[model samples]
Target: MSNYPINPSTIAAPHSQSPLGANISSASLTTEQEFETGIRIIRDAYRKKIATKDAEIDALYKDLRRRDAEIQ
Candidate 1:
């Protein structure tokens, strides 16, 4: 419910755990457009990696099938 934005600067340095015993420096803020574009790029890269893995799995299955047919 708090309207305040959260970042390193806004966060309270935990009194008991902080080595510096102080809050961290301000974090770099990202614009909405920049954030969305970054997210999209990351998603595309992840999807591509998954697709490549799927293709490799399919190739392994095909090789197994071929070997089984040869044995039979």
Candidate 2:
């Protein structure tokens, strides 16, 4: 054969589809808007979740102190 390399066809599958891929149509404006909105919503949710968790931890600490006083 000429000065060329032979690669297996099965080994050359595509790594990834184009940036947006077939899942998102190029003309879908609502998808883009929702994506941005989703990012903001998730961020807000995370903040609220953290605040709730902190409140629970504080309550647990108070309960522990009350129980410790009973043990003394």
User: Evaluated with lDDT, which candidate comes out highest?
Assistant: 2
lDDT value for model 1: 0.67
lDDT score, candidate 2, position 9: 71
Task: Give the TM-scores of the predictions, in the order they appear.
Answer: 0.57, 0.49
Give the per-residue lDDT of model 2 (tens digit) for 1-72. Answer: 779777777464544333333444544345555576567778989999999999999999999999999999
lDDT of 1 by residue, 1-72 (tens): 999777887677544333221222423333454466567778999999999999999999999999999999
- Error at 65, model 2, angstroms: 0.7
Tell me how candidate 2 scores on lDDT. 0.70
Question: Which ranges of candidate 1 are over 4 A from the true structure?
Answer: 1-30
